[model samples]
Target: MLFLNRADAGRRLATRLTGFAGPDTIVLGLPRGGVPVALEVARALGAPLDVVVVRKLGSPLNPEYALGAIGAGGVRVVDTDAMRALGVTAREIDSTEVRERAELERRTVRFRGTRAELDLAGKTAIVVDDGIATGSTARAACLIVREMGASRIVLAVPVAPRDWIARIGGAADEFVCLETPAHFFAVGQWYADFTQTTDEEVSAALATTRVT
Candidate 1:
């Protein structure tokens, strides 16, 4: 089974999420990729949309493997063990957090424009992403939303490794991932047209969500 892209993956994921929609429910996208998927889910659910900004605090060298992630309002979630494995100093982590914090603010200004953020407190919030590789970013997002007082959190990802899903267990009130295969090669592997989700596409999806 393969997906066309984020939008197609989203529509499919939305079916599973039908059980979670209501007046007190909302959809939050992890942007630069998750926006398109979240937009479709928001449209299907008739819920308000917002971005939960979380940028990975990467290793000093690789930078792809996330050592942690920084979210809105100066909140940071770290993987202390990962840091130790990489021999990352506290100073390095602090520096990366500062940089990621700035990126989060920039994305907020770009994606939000002048719109006020939706209050997520006491809501059944579904935090979404294209897929999970390391799951660090998603885990961080879950924590940040919890801080916002979300009544229950449902993490909706199109695909993720079973182990990654297990790692995030109970962080969300109910976790909904469409696929968790053993091979778990990559998100692209399960997709037929897993093209890059560009920033322009993300912005357009966000615009559509605003008035939907």
Candidate 2:
């Protein structure tokens, strides 16, 4: 199934997650694309919304191909198989992490400002993203949230490959994926309006969460 947009997809996802709504539940979106989708979920569930800023550690040669991801609290998830196959050395991986971690911090400040990060301790943290490709970012996100003391981690997304759902499912207490098409090539292919989500849009989405 194709989504009209991230907002539409989010509304549908929220319906499936209604049972989890309450004071104990918090929705964390992986910006900047996930923020738009997550805003709808946060509103529907009447839960607080937060951004989980994670940066993809892309291959030096092919920047689009993520070797892994880096998230808050210095959590990092690397695909050892991908690294070995591509002959990526430890030094290269470290260099990439340094760059991505810097960006991750910048985004955290840009999106959150003076507001301290939401305390996930003893709370059910539902992590949302626009979609999953290799699942590296989502995996990293789950680990990061868990490190922050979340009692449970739920990874939610609009679309993902069936294989990816299986691969990353173990990382969270629950994995909720709206679309798991076998022919999935990229997340954008399943969206009618797959425009790039901007920082300004992300901030606007977060603003709605504050007043909700």
Candidate 3:
């Protein structure tokens, strides 16, 4: 199924997640693209929305290839097999992580400013993203939320590969996806307008939700 944009995808994804709507449930979006999609879900569910800042640790050789991911509260998910196969050393991984961690901090500050992070203690956290590709960032987000004391975790996305569950099934208690296309190539391929979401757009989305 092709989506007009992230908003369209989020509305579709929210339909699959009606069971999660409640006071105890909170929606966390992976910025900056995920925020738009998640905003729609939050509106539909009447759940508080927040950002789960995570960064993809790209391989040293091929920057597009993810070696792992890092999230808030020092949560990290490294792919040992991928590192060994790519001949990536510990030093290389450390360097990559350092770079990503800095960006993650910057984004957190930019998006959240001085606001305290949402208290996830004993609450149900629904992690939302526009789509899943490598699934590394989504996994890291789940771990971060779990660390924050969420009682239950749900990973929701609009689209993913048919084998996506196998890739990220262990991260959350429940997984809700709108589409798992068999011939999936990339997340952007399924969207008519896959425009890059900006920091301002993310901030605006958060600001609007904070008041409502």
Candidate 4:
């Protein structure tokens, strides 16, 4: 099914996640695109919403390739196999991590402002993304949430390829992907209008979910 947009996709995805609504549940969206989709889920579930800022440690020569990712609180996940195959050095990884971590911190502040991060200890942490592509960043998010002491981790997205389920399923306690197309090319292809979600939209969505 083609989604009208992320908001529409999110509302549809939220229906599949109705059973997870509770005080112990916290919905965390991967920023830039995932926040709008997550807002709908949070609203439908009556759960608190937050952004989990993570930066892709792109390959030095090919910026599109993610060799690793860095999350909040210094959480890092690396693909050693990819690094080794690409002849990436430890020094290169460290330098790339430093650069990405700096941007991650900046985005965390920009998106969340004064809102203290929700303590995920013993809570059901639901990580939401608009869609999954390479699944590296989403895998990194699940690991980071697990490190934060979450009792359970659920990875939810509007759409993904079947390969992603096989790829990152181990990281999440439960995977709640709405549509897993066999011929998936890109996340945007499944949407009618997959425009880039702006920073203002993300910040506004977060404000609507802020604890009063």
Top candidate by lDDT: 4
Q: Estimate each model's TM-score.
A: 0.87, 0.86, 0.87, 0.91
Candidate 2, residues 80-196, lDDT tens digits: the string is: 899899989889999988888888889888988777788889999999999998887787788778767899988989888888767675679998888899788899999999999
Off by over 4 Å in 1: 59-67, 79-90
1 or 2, greater by TM-score: 1
Per-residue lDDT over 89-126 for candidate 4, one digit per residue giving the tens place of the 0 to 100 score:
98999998888888889999999888888888999999
- Candidate 3 residues lying further than 4 Å off, grouped into runs, are 58-68, 76-92
CA lDDT, candidate 2, residue 89: 89
- Candidate 2 ranges beyond 4 A from true positions: 57-68, 75-92
lDDT, candidate 1, 114-152, per-residue tens: 777778878899999989887877887898888778989
Please report the TM-score between candidate 4 and the true structure. Answer: 0.91
Which stretches of candidate 4 lie above 4 Å from their native place? Answer: 61-65, 79-87
Q: TM-score winner among the candidates?
A: 4
The local distance difference test score of each candidate is 0.83, 0.86, 0.88, 0.89
Using alpha carbons, what is the TM-score of model 2? Answer: 0.86
Clashing pairs for model 2 are: none
TM-score order of candidates, best first? 4, 3, 1, 2
lDDT of 3 by residue, 18-71 (tens): 899988999999998899999999999999899999787788878867777787
Task: Using lDDT, rank the candidates from best to worst.
Answer: 4, 3, 2, 1
